[model samples]
Target chain A: MEAGGRLTEDALIARYFAPLAGAGADALRDDAATLTPSPGHDLVLTADAIVAGVHYFPEDPPASIARKALGVNLSDLAAKGALPRGFLLTLALPPDWTEAWLEGLADGLREASEAFGCPLLGGDTVRAAGPALLGITALGEVPAGRMVRRPTAQAGDRICVTGTIGDAALGLALRLTPEAPWAVALTEAERAHLLDRYLHPRPRLALAPALRRFASAAMDVSDGLVGDLAKMLRGAGRGAGVSLAAIPLSPAAASAVAAAPGLLDTAFTGGDDYEILCTVPPGQLDAFRGEALEAGIAVAVIGSVEAEAGAPVFSTEDGAPRAFASGSFSHF
Target chain B: MEAGGRLTEDALIARYFAPLAGAGADALRDDAATLTPSPGHDLVLTADAIVAGVHYFPEDPPASIARKALGVNLSDLAAKGALPRGFLLTLALPPDWTEAWLEGLADGLREASEAFGCPLLGGDTVRAAGPALLGITALGEVPAGRMVRRPTAQAGDRICVTGTIGDAALGLALRLTPEAPWAVALTEAERAHLLDRYLHPRPRLALAPALRRFASAAMDVSDGLVGDLAKMLRGAGRGAGVSLAAIPLSPAAASAVAAAPGLLDTAFTGGDDYEILCTVPPGQLDAFRGEALEAGIAVAVIGSVEAEAGAPVFSTEDGAPRAFASGSFSHF
Candidate 1:
């Protein structure tokens, strides 16, 4: 489980990649992985890369790294309401990894692939001296006309979100300083909840059908809520006003906020939240919530889209507008 | 161009990736690049990575790097007799490259994209500390029944190759030692031919139709004539005898061999020859030559496949064999 040691590329591939089984094109040996498109569905494909250090902790378990790598790409397909088909993985590995680490990583990929109903089709592996990097290209399919896009939101659409926000960011803050006052006071269950959110984010593929049924503009919340929502607004050529008080937080997160007022910064700007942030027309909100409930996804109406462009307004419970120091994580 | 400079990931991406004119998917800007399968042809996809020191001169022009990055993958598809379709590029940039270097690289990609009739589909760009690297996932397609594979060669197959062989290897040697005695004697046309072979290898897509007409199995000779042919034999589950004297060497390469007695080592083991190596049934060799001639491709008989499996035997003009110090490049 050591972060930087114990895996040869060949051994890692054998342990982590060999057992993947599926009914896709040719079973993992050719130069390119192939998938036969289903008759009634449109094929959706996407590729994303996770660089070491920038995306994950260098010391984190390889399994967690693998999950995050594949999970993030799948999350995009989920937002499009596509059914999982298959994926192609490309890896650049540092020479120090042992066989066990790679096996653990592949175990994570296999678990996610099966859990999400997608199977590994093919991939390439190489050696690198720098941090290990991964590029995963995922393929999916959806019935014609069901895929959602970010530029289609209506002026009066209600902005909605799935699950609680800010917890993954909170978990990241705690991991950075485990001895911080907020971290020391957490209950075991709360700590585990935060850690799990940081480690393994579940892409909401199951909710895709309902999303396509009702949502207008849709995208995963990867950058912080304020930033990603702002992007969605820009993509749709609109704007939104969010009720800061209405932003959902776990009980533990609320407690952490109470203890350390600065935790709000983590809540607003920290990235890696994979939950779907979407816009639904006012009349469809009720039906959308009902379907999401049936699908076991937490649904919340946090704001409404504006007809014109402006900065997102955040309001406190007392109707006082609050100020945010930063909007999102900046690559620069 | 210098080899090791730092460039921001965003700046590199902007400089190197032109706005793809007709990319079919919107998810390309979101979390992943998307693809919708084209109807009719079976999609042929393949990815290959070129590391700085391993694949080319550390200080080669970025444009040449860009061309070769894509050209190598196209060569593989060409060997399969597939038409050029589209490509996804993944670039890991060393920090030192300037904006101009990246622009030149993009220009090269754009040139090849147009020349090969493949459009730029999607890709990821990132920064790395070690060597500059490129991973290209090329997608092509052909009619279901026309695609060729390496395992289809039959016994009594008349192994043939398109174009002369040793030019690229000789070019590499000249590039490595520009002032070497052997390189100094080359005329202007010969030097241009050698450098062009090294820098911008034609992928042989033009000969794909003829290959379909005559070749039982085909592949681009990348690793070297001996080694790559060994791979084809392995794929076909057969072995063969090669006449070293019959192997076609370019005029410059022949001169280099005459100048230095051991220069054949460069011809035999040096890599990056992207010419097509194929097997035609003995009875079809005449027809194969006719088709190749009509297509304006040079065809030469090099060897024949036997019903046995082992190391390939290489004999000289007098039928006496000699031992080869090395046959191909091995990453390990």
Candidate 2:
């Protein structure tokens, strides 16, 4: 067709995508992919999109963008207490794409796909007149009737989070800042840690099994802990009291916050954390923590759910409520 | 959250998407959705995307855009001999999006989702600085190991296509022509017929069961019959010889072709013909045709597979090979 159109498209798939195709993908030749499920398991589905300029800098590395695209959807599956299975990718590329760019992207996708156990299925690639967009729909599996939900938190359940928070937010701030102030104050290792967390978030997939076994309610802390916890509380028709002093933070984030108290607001309101925020019953907190530790993940009890329904209260060590100028990061 | 960002997003989902969510969507409150697969079946996954100004006209109706986004993916499932199940949608909206536009889009998606038995599972909505984009990953189910493939056509297989092939190509030609001469020559009903074909393609899902039972190789004619047939043949490691006279054409398309013989190339090479192109064995031809008729679909045996592996040849009534300037319409 159109001189080299058909040949180009066929060759592109064969070269870049064929290697990523799983057993059900038919080497990317069939119109669709076939995924046979484990008889008694249920499939968890989630879709997410990242557009150029909105989600990442145009100058961002293609590999990082590719990993982020798949990682975001994987985070959703982890929050749902499902194990990553496979995914479909839709790439809307601009006219200026190059062979090197494509190779970089493929390399990144291959790495993430292998790391997460989510092989590529069938997808469409089309040219766009505007900025490029990367979209992915990830599929996961869990035992029947066992998916962790966000609206099942009960009164007296302890609010818990995995890993650390605010590193990504502070990292993004550092990345965007011109002649960054943290550059001189923080050690080189700490700066790199924050930047790495911002560019490549490690979704708490290791905690999914434990969450399914013990968590009363669960959601990924994407749009800041303050806002996401508020959403979970609102959905459960309950309230939460989070202790600012108990919130887990990376050593780098703590140093930045200590250096400039104003940075604390950025940590609380900025998003892109990608850490798991879950509620476990008081009786099961010890068990959940032990299991999480066994899985090589740090778990911390940050708050408790209350029967009274209202905005989540963030209390300081002095028992005074801390207020944020903004609740969560919103692209709009 | 930025003033109305989160609130607007919540309102949009509540107003337009909540009604379309299936049983496992959890009223769209959870980050992901759960789908229980039917026992003894494999899930067929397909994904497609459409961007403004590339796949459709900027001024086209929002409802039509929505249908095309989902319709393209449905055609993939049909070609694979699968039944519609559920889908996840990701939308990247421009700042100018309005409630009215969203309502129209939702109406179209809802209508198609119901008609195809593909319900909304879960999705993400995000803001973009560029043109809007819509992507969908459709899920379908078929009996284990029963999916129709493209690499099974034998040497003696009869190449058949459903419905008419050239209507959509001709319809698109008429649409792109400003102050068109054909408009005055064709009747109002005929003109509308051609326009409707271009705007909304009917995926041949009704004939899927027959295709699975009788067809040896199959694929939907998205990138024109000649090119797509060549693809099937390439996958099967075979070649084909088609008779140009045997190609089916609608009354409107027949009239247009009669008026301008040169339009034949456009009819043969233009893409967006969502009809099914399949190859049936000689022994199963009768059964396939009978079943297709019962399903109220037109089936035409316009070609035959050859032993040689090469580009497909299109022969005229005089037995002379006819050539097209291009094989298929390619966006690249």
Candidate 3:
């Protein structure tokens, strides 16, 4: 907690993480946790890592870093139509990290765990000589043979997305340039809304049940809508024709795009949207919409799956196909 | 492939990790993997992370680094008396990392996965601005409600350990000081044996079934015998009296200790000895030994559990209680 001296690994774990360990975690003392599978449920596995300076700024709060680390993994489970059960965290911290930072991170993780019904089962904490790297392996359970896969979308299926797209990407843009000429035209509340979307992702766990029942193929859009949709299409050996104008955009993002038409490419191609991109059969569209609305979520039909085997194509309102400066974000 | 230009994240994953993915991995294109549990089996979950400078030297072989990353997690599953299932990997790589290094790492991971019967399920790869960090979440399966735990050790149990102790510690010492007067006397084979023990740990998965049937408590010794045994005792509300002379040591380690008598403290306190440390009933000692022998593993009884709530005490051949120079390796 106090860096190297006076705070041993055992004491640090006991003080910061032992209390967060839920049932089956053995109070963070055991080598592994025992988790009984619910009868007739299959397990879903997803692992994600977020690094300081790469995923978030070094000036970002520790709580946001922790939330984003777990939130990204949770988003994967939600896309897979699985209910969150538990997770294991592997944290690599620098020597300069402080006890107060760990406390903030634990507080954020605890809040997310309780809110999402996913508890911290077990984890490893190691000292790093580099920037902090936080990883989470989240486990979820879905009924046997019920997981929504990315390779099962059928031709003619209606492609839909939850919440809004491009908000987080625009929010990131705003964060990097709050005083830019285009950004200064926006209201302070609009700026905050965009920034909030970037910092905190709301994984659609509430929609998993609905998605399980209605979606033919689904995935979380973390790497931009155009690129992630292309991945899903490639996996399914199918293609799609999406309407860029139909894609839902937050009011703040819409305002930004209105101020600078060139920002549309950034809105469509930037990553970290954390929204579900799924194909729903036409027959289930009404039911899916009703269920999502009942759950206080917004759903939009953005496109239709084409019979051709190719990448998704985004077209403008005038039927001209749009080309992004970059298809999606990639680390390498 | 280049670090950040021609070798994209997708291409890097395809080149290095796609072939390592086992059944239900969905070719690593999907955001998450689906796994159906075998009937009557519960999951044993464990995670561990190792950083470049903290756990291994930056110049260590990529293959050994990969093995250590996965081996440490597998060791946890072995300690829980579970069969290896599958694992998720999260890797943070620096900009200077090379394709050849990843190739070697993938080769090592593939071999270990095949040897341990634990395949890759899915993973996330991201770029970092600092030293590499690798995290693994290894899962296993045990019969429902039958996971071996450290807190189940009985007072009258005989504390047994698998294989030789202190070899890895000695190996580390030799690595740090090959030209030292104490290390210069070792034969080439002896030095290789110690170095191999430190670089590639053989997780005692073969002993899991025997432990499940015979042991009262079990855990992998990664943080040295002195501290880890104390941890087991504290967990079980018991104590142990271990005879240092009775603790099994490799021929190479024994010779090293003979050369430098002060290395005994290092042997007892240094970490990275990934062996199964367990407690068996005195009555089942013979049967446990036989089963372990049949499985091609050596078992040694080095201590006895005592009916007291305290730390473990190590005694020399003359019955003098030994004191360690350091309790255990702590990164914080």
Candidate 4:
């Protein structure tokens, strides 16, 4: 290939990635980016990497991979109550990579970049011996010292969750086994809903402003609700009383749980949900919910933070503590 | 493994990486980091990844691997004339990763972080099927809108480089074939010098301020000088006239070239120098040199930019041009 041919790194970047660069990216010609934070804001930074087979199947559509990668990082920014700024990408493609696949991924990145309002700043692209891995370092801006953080929830804080839980877990189950016994009971549309949830995570960025205004603490749910919420409280001398029945479930997840009630545990404990799990003080719960409703996001009060030191889940009917095999999935 | 087992992701970060976190990292208690850029400064961001077996030998010391990973990114920021603030890391280790290796890597990171003034802010750790890959997104601070950029070199500008040029190239040569004739002819200290240069890169952070103050255009020499210098001029209607004899070479590299005359080309064409390649207006060259001397960094002027559009090197004696098969090494 000539120096400027599409096969070379410079050509590849200029052809597929530069168009996504914005503002201070210098069209990615400078190999670095400069971000001048607005006077009143601080930068919230988060990085998340997804590997083929581990995070998603190698067969997953390129666009879906892009969505999941950007979605997961954007979700963290949203939970921190920050507005999107831009992102740096690290793409390590396997030796067997083909141009067609790369084009699909680039197109996927363009769509996700535009949708999340996170432009591509710059990135490192190289060929690795392993399966493909896409890592993103996303930058967001929050008013100085106003970023919602963990272990700040008070004893009376009402724990609320945005959107529904367990959809991702159910989606993964369906992907792993299209003929899962419970899946067989679902209609085609239900199956598609579950799969889409697993494939494309819709970040709840619309609620970011309200989160910083009203949330005492907040975290994005990635490693399941039970474990992630526990993480938010683990480092501090605090506990939470959660009603599993109050954890909103999507219509598809509800259908799956109805067909096989045991799947309820999977819904609550399985990972890859990107919704925001936050705590609102008793005084702010009404306004928080009102804002979430205005943002057109589903807000449900799942439980409350307590002075106790361990997480306890109840069915909310007879109020009996339930046992689970594990709190969340472990990559190790 | 238990939830807090050392093998688990959370435990791994807490045990080995969390201590490196500083300032807004919240001690890694939060999964993400917040960087509050000081007013009047812009955040200069850059990311680079090094994969084992591709960027380094799988058998290379874990500490050496860590140094290279941090050094390369820090070098970019240095070239940008930005002061290091903090960095985010993405570590994907192979399935066979050991605790001892991880411990060594962490210690290396601690040392580099302290030395570079760039603390670890946050990171993501995952397991991959292939060799380990270390990715870092480093942030630096520079005066707003003052970042020195590429393709800005003007005709009559002097081309300068810091430190010795080809030690890394020779070092890599020894590492691959310690029994080569050239290796057998070198002194023990000479061999060690070359190997050390290859194993650990010393980022010239000291020259950063001087670069931004005086350089019209600049870039780090990660790839060979021949190619990278060409890159600096390729986008613009500019070229350079370099005197090959003026290119600085360490005693070790000079010895290697004497033993194998052809190695001169490799010296100029090899990668991983991590030194700054910059252009200064002729009128400011003396002042730039003085500042570099104050910083205790060796700076050499080897070439001059011209209105012509291609990079051509001459042997000052005869003023004859030399031909090379390729300019820089292609990662692909």
- List model 1 lDDT by residue over A1-332, tens digit each: 22355443334545567678465334443344445666667666666677776677778888888888889888888887777887777777776766667777888888888888888876667777677777777777878656788777888898888988888888888888999988998888888888888878789898889888999979888778888887778777887888887888888788888888899878777777789999999999999999999999998888899989866778888878877777766432
Q: TM-scores of the models, in the given order?
A: 0.90, 0.97, 0.98, 0.98
lDDT of 1 by residue, B176-272 (tens): 8989887898887888888889888789888888787778988888778887787778766798888988888888788888987587877877777
Best by DockQ: 3
Off by over 4 Å in 2: A1-7, A180-183, B1-7
Native contact share for candidate 1: 0.27
Per-residue lDDT tens digits of candidate 3, residues B1-332?
Answer: 44335578888888889999988887787788888767888899999988888788889999999999899889989989999889999999887898889899999999888888999999889888888988999999998878899888999899998899888888898989889887999889889999999999899999999989999999999988888888888889999899888888898888888999898877777888999999999999999999999999999999999998887888989999888867776544
Q: Which candidate would rank higher by TM-score, 1 or 4?
A: 4
- Preferred candidate (TM-score higher): 2 or 3: 3
User: What are the DockQ scores of the candidates, in order?
Assistant: 0.37, 0.78, 0.80, 0.77
lDDT (C-alpha) at residue B133 in model 3: 87
What is the C-alpha local distance difference test score of each model?
0.77, 0.87, 0.88, 0.89
Error of 4 at A69 (Å): 0.9
